[model samples]
Target: DMEIKNTNTIQYRSMVDKLIFLTNIRLDIAFVVPYVSKFMQTPQQTHLWAMKGILQYI
Candidate 1:
């Protein structure tokens, strides 16, 4: 699988950081949040999609 770097790096990182904070109260997302956070430095479109899905889940 090819991973394309996200152009909206700042936005992605910001959202992921928010998710990281959410993980404390939202136990269900604890696992997934860290998984997505791994890509924060170089998030791809897929990563952003995952973040959106997480937001929808919340």
Candidate 2:
């Protein structure tokens, strides 16, 4: 993925948004989403990877 600015960017915004939505609907599966969501103000690549893994797990 291309390196970009901060959470204001589209990619990060979309990823975090999806994670939040999915987490709300499937809390039992991706319980970690809430914790990860805390970083939405300034998420990093690690958070994105974790969200991706959570997506795969779900």
Candidate 3:
């Protein structure tokens, strides 16, 4: 679990937005997207990595 303070807020927000948009059209990542999106305001490196993994899957 990575700390939220050290993670990139901008990138995390961007990715979460993208994932939310994608979730509207893609069902596969819907579950993970919401799980990770829960930390939108204060995301960690681990959350970012999880989002990256989902993005890579797509």
Candidate 4:
């Protein structure tokens, strides 16, 4: 089994970028994408939890 590491600079950037692009077509995720982006500099467990919740909403 492997543990999931929530923070990976390149991967996180890539994902956030994709989410930003998706925002154009999915207005519903717009707010959440930016919301998640703000924590990129120093993401914490709570931020990841929030993002998961947002994803579930979407």
Computed on alpha carbons, the lDDT of every model, listed in order, comes to 0.81, 0.68, 0.80, 0.68
lDDT of 2 by residue, 1-49 (tens): 4447543355656876787777667768566756866876777777677
Q: How many steric clashes between backbone atoms does each model show?
A: 0, 0, 0, 0
The number of the candidate with the highest TM-score is: 1
Which 10 residues in a row give candidate 3 its minimum summed lDDT?
A: 1-10
Pairs that collide, model 1: none
TM-score of 4: 0.62
Instruction: Please tell me which model should have the higher lDDT, number 1 or number 3.
Output: 1
From the highest TM-score down, the ranking of the candidates is: 1, 3, 4, 2
TM-score for each candidate, following the candidate numbering: 0.81, 0.61, 0.78, 0.62
> Candidate 1 — worst ten consecutive residues by lDDT sum?
1-10
lDDT tens digits, residue span 1-58, model 1? 3333445677798998898899889998988877887887877777788889989999
C-alpha-based local distance difference test score of model 2 = 0.68
Per residue, candidate 3 scores C-alpha lDDT tens digits across 2-50 of 4446458778888888988988789888788778878888776787788
Structural RMSD, model 3: 3.6
The digit string of per-residue lDDT tens for model 4 on 4-48 reads 443454445566777788788889898678778987865666766
Model 1, which residues run further than 4 Å from truth? 1-7
Between prediction 1 and prediction 4, the one with superior TM-score is 1
Error of 3 at 16 (Å): 0.7
